[model samples]
Target: MDLQLPRGMRDFPPEEKILRDEVIAILKNLFELYGFSPLETPVVERWEALSAKYSGGEEILKETFKLTDQGGRQLGLRYDLTVPLARFVGMNPTIKRPFKRYQIGTVYRDGPIKKGRTREFYQCDADIVGSSSPLADAECVQLALDVFERFKIDVVVKINNRKVLYELVRAAQIPEKFTEAAILSLDKLDKIGPDEVIREMVERGIERTSAERFLSGAQDPQAFKNSEGYRELEPVLSALRDSRVVWTPSLARGLSYYTGTIYEVYAKDSSVTGSLAAGGRYDNMIGQFLGGTEKIPAVGISFGLEPILEVLKEQRRDLPLRKTVTQVYVIPFKTLVAEGRAVCQRLRRAGIKTDIDFSAKGISDGLKYANAYAIPFVVIVGPDEVAQGKVKLRDMRSGEEQLLTVEEVARQVAQRLS
Candidate 1:
């Protein structure tokens, strides 16, 4: 008998799960700080809705894991959050305009797996609905920048305009009918060399001359300054001019719905193979769901929780990655479990993460247990300390000990933690 997860999926153990949670906590806080409220959508979405025009463009559909329910209705796990967001807004209709929302949840992709790509992962997305202003795009940029800064990861924020890319395709003599395919191929420009990109474009039916010409111009943002996309993207870059953002002309976010600016984030000098976060201004997806009478403009950014955890885990090795959230471990001396239980409750009441060894163990063995679980502080409870209304608090890291009253123990631990 074989017990295993499907390909490209993984079960995160405590240490890994703790790191993932840390990333989520930071992103959730940052998302709300910028006026984006929280939103939740079902993990399984209708086949119709998932395949609708509002969904993540054609490329992602290749990875959609389709399923048939017992009732014979078709369903697919959500591949991304932005599509669900569009669907939710489309159905509600009266959701106030310029709705700012953020969602952090599981997303599935049955695509090829790589160093940073996974089949089942988490996306933390923040978006604005009913607005076409580049300021909204700019706001996403600043928010994304803040996110990386908080993580202490050095990254380059890359910006591009889909409109500008379209013009470059036109200028390169690529047929209008093959524009989407051209953009998809161009998206690999940074991954594959220009020669391979041209080869891929040609293989996809683009003329070699046109692919070559487009590849050359796409690398230079100044090549399309006369296009409206360049103008539309100007305000955003201007707003973030001092932020050291790069005008990445060829950033084809690989999504057909990206009607305007596209954003991608990459860690600087890191081995991660893909963008840590990305998004764009998608102005038409929701309208398609709403029957096209009204325009619902939107922009968003999504942070990949897995890739971030990977980066943090690699870059922040000095950070204590603990299996448990417990800050203090209580070891009862001999048959002193009851007294230790009292101390545990007192620490828990003070909002301290406390865990008590219900089975009494020797002081030396208890310290080993606490250290093994990555617990930082250990309280030794014995008959003497119990009678004296005090405990021996030992710092696992420094092995420093202090004999203090329970009140003093809580105060000192809380202060050091803060």
Candidate 2:
């Protein structure tokens, strides 16, 4: 029998896992620095919670991986973190208002896999709920910019509003029934190009001249001030004037729930084909969960972890790599295994990442192993050193050796690594 892994999934080995963890750590630290607290939700959610109305739209719903439990309960893996966050806020209303939270987790979607698209991927999200101020939206944009800046990735943030799209559709005289279809077609402008998008819209029963006019109007920011969407976006634009942001009317985000401002991030020079991150304000989703007419204003941005890593790799950025957790490798002569263990314990107690070779291999083989793992230091515990209550510490990088007490070795390594 041949064993195989599923398509569009991956196994992150040690080196890749370390790089991934480092990315997560950097994002977490930045999120915390921006006063966002961390929160987590279960991977599996009830089917109803992820249906079209709450999730995004019919397109996203179709891509959700639906399943049934042994008890015949319908469930689905969360396609995105925003829907779960809305459900969480609704279930726990006593939580503080204006809640700020960040979540990093894997989300699954059953969709056509491509270079940057996959069935399972990690999303790092930061959101602010219960804030109606456009500052919340601006902050989300700034946070995304900061993340890319930290990685030294040049990016251009495209901003738009759903209300603007609606007005543009109205301006185009696209019939009410075909509005969603037209918007979806427009959303593909980046991928399919203007000509194809116009062709698609024309095929969808929209007038060619009207579609052309609408596309032209969208490119000019001055043409949108009459729109309520323009009014909503004015403050956000003001807030982000110092950043690399542009009003991209063509960015529809392909989400039905985005009631207000929306954003998408693109790498300026990257081999990856899609946005690095995207999100928007969904003012009514939380209200749907509460069964109330009152809206709970919410805004968020999610980083596409896999695509960001791909871009970084393509750019040849240096990523952290350590084959083992051991900062120091302790090798003992055949007779000094007990002493090696004791030394290892002391080093560990002192917060040093220490490992000992239990194979009782020759010193040459042990040194080879240490070098293979790129361990910085190696401690040799042999008969003479044990008798003197000392150990020989070899600096792997420098090939220098020194005889010192175990405590002295620990102190020196700790200070040097620190």
Give residue 135's lDDT in candidate 1 (0 to 100).
91
Put down candidate 2 lDDT per residue, 176-230, tens digits, no spaces. Answer: 8888887888888888898998898899888899888777776677888778998
Clashing residue pairs, candidate 2?
A: none
Q: Pairing residues by index, what is the TM-score of model 1?
A: 0.97
Off by more than 4 A, model 2: 317-320
TM-score of each: 0.97, 0.94
Q: CA shift at 260, candidate 2, in angstroms?
A: 1.0
Cα displacement (angstroms), candidate 1, residue 33, comes to: 0.9
lDDT of 1: 0.89
Q: What is the C-alpha lDDT of each candidate?
A: 0.89, 0.90
